[model samples]
Target: MQTMRPNPSRSDHKAIALMYLAFFVLGLVGSMTGPLVPALRHIFALDFRQAMAAQWLVLVVIGALAWPAARLMQSWGVFRLLCLALGLMAAGCLAVSFAAGSGYFASVLLALAVIATGTTLLQVAGNPLTTALGAPEKSHARLALAQGFNSLGVLGGVHLGSSLMLGQDAAQGVQLTYGILAVLTLAGLAMFLCGGKAFPTSALANETAAPSEALTSRWAWAGAAAIALYVGAEGAIGSIMINFLHQPHVLNLPMAEAGRASAKIYWGGALAGRFAGSWLLTRYRAPRLLGLMAALACALCLTVAVTQGPMAGYAALAIGLCNAIMFPTIFSLTLARSKAPASAVSGLLCTAIAGGALISILVGEMADHTGLAQAFLVPLVAYGLIALFAALKPAIWPQG
Candidate 1:
């Protein structure tokens, strides 16, 4: 097994700042599906399963592109890859803005695929870069801190996206919102172009393993499964939250208000937890804390499954807090333990995120057939599996 030794000098503050900005924008763009669901449903006359197809498409593109993106990063370097991704995201946003009221659902999906492609590249480059920009011992804490900024982006994105895209004039709102996002993405692209030299050019540039090498490592497969389950559970819960809260048995808020509440309570909890988790990772063992959070998230999902009214709604929302540390912790822990190259392992992990689409589709089917509350059983099982993974000895501590 080869250990990824972090060079303290490569941990440049400018590079770290750039990574944070990238993560923040990624969060903002990545979180659009949940807030945009109601508008999409209204526009397309979609059912639960149909509405979920939007998210499915996004994750599917991400999975499909993860490997290629990793290979490209290996050759082109992170800075160039990031620049390309940002440009693609901006172009995709502009296309979406144009297609908003054109009444062509396929156009929207196509635009979203483009956006997902950009997002895949960003994640492929950003995750390893963040880890490389700091000490290996502090990888967990540093990644969590970056993810905190990501959550901050999610918090603001959800609020503004929901308010704009879920309004009375949904089409106009979509056009205006995405148009603004296009401009913002272009601004990020300009920043990266001008500050390209600030990024550590040599970081992770030596990881030349074929993607198949990652498949041979048990740690890679195990970590992939954990990432899949975590992403699936989180996506399923978030995708259905607004509709769940709008149910007669729950808060019964309007679609717009429900979206706002989901933003405030659900994603907001994640924001707080990520910041807090960043600090806690420095003081605690990463896997132990991950296990604790997964267990609590599982318990909360159970409450949502069996309970009714505000209790169930809040319980579902509270899962975000428990989810805050899971992704970064699982990722950093896997990197520490895996025998595979960092790029290969990262590509595998990002590919696993496509499981979110599958889980979300299942939840949608369950919501259509078994009822929304019972649909939480899917994520509950996922969180339980993650907890079990965390309890494994190899996962609990780094190998020598």
Candidate 2:
């Protein structure tokens, strides 16, 4: 790997700022569904599973494009690729703004698919590059910092959608909200282009290397499964929090209030946890923390599944605290475990994020058949799997 710049220049700082901005935007746009679930259902006249299908499309694209993105990143480099992803996001937002006016569900879905395509590429480039920008030993901390901004974006976006996109007129709300997103995306693209010369793409060197070791490692696969389950479980939980809180027997807030509530508990907890996790990972073994957090998340989900009222609400919210460090921790641990290059391991791990689609769909369907609270069993199971992976990580990678 190319060594990082010990003393970054002015342009390098600009590049880092733009990259982190892109990460924030990714979280903002990606988490839109959770808060807008009520709007999607009301506007489209759909059920739980149908509204949840929005994520299915996004994750499908992410999974499909992430693995091949290593070659693309190699050819284009991070700066150019990020600019392209921002452009794609802007275009998707533009499409959404227009499509939403007509209340056409298909158009919005298509726009999100395009957005996810860009996001997948961005993640493939951004996640590892954060570590590359500094010392290698601090990768876990750096990734946590990137994901901290992502969590902030999620918190902001959810509240934004709740206020602007969920109301008596869903189409109007979407139009206004997405119009703002498009403009912001374009602005981000412009800023990145001006400083584009400073960004490096050394990780893209994965293209020149063999993937045999990464492909063969059991720890790699185990880590992939752990990531998949973690994402899936998080998605499942996010997808339901609005509706779960909307239940009259539970929090019983209106859709907007429910969304605000979820943002505070779900995304807010993540935002705080990630910033703290950045420091915590420096003090603790990544796998041990991962196992403990996953176990705690499992307990929280189980509590949500079986309980009601404020207890359930508190439990569900607490899960985000446990979830805060899992992704970056898992990514860093898996990267260490892999014998392949950073870029190759990043692609595989990014693709495994498709678990969100599969698991969220299952949770949604279960909600349709059973109840929203009980449907949380799906994430409960997922968290359990991740906990198992964390606990057995030493067995899986005894040499470490």
Instruction: Predict model 2's lDDT versus the native.
Output: 0.80
Q: Quote the lDDT for 276 in model 2.
A: 96
Best by lDDT: 1
lDDT of 1 by residue, 207-315 (tens): 8876667887788888989998988888778888988998989889898899899898899999999999999999999989999999999899999999999999899
Q: List the candidate 2 regions with Cα displacement exceeding 4 Å.
A: 1-14, 201-207, 210-213, 394-400
**Alpha-carbon error at 35 in model 1, in Å?**
1.3
Q: Clashing residue pairs in candidate 2, if any?
A: none
Q: What is the TM-score of each candidate against the true structure?
A: 0.96, 0.94
Please, what is the whole-model Cα lDDT of each candidate in the order they appear? Answer: 0.86, 0.80
What's the lDDT for residue 203 in model 1?
A: 71
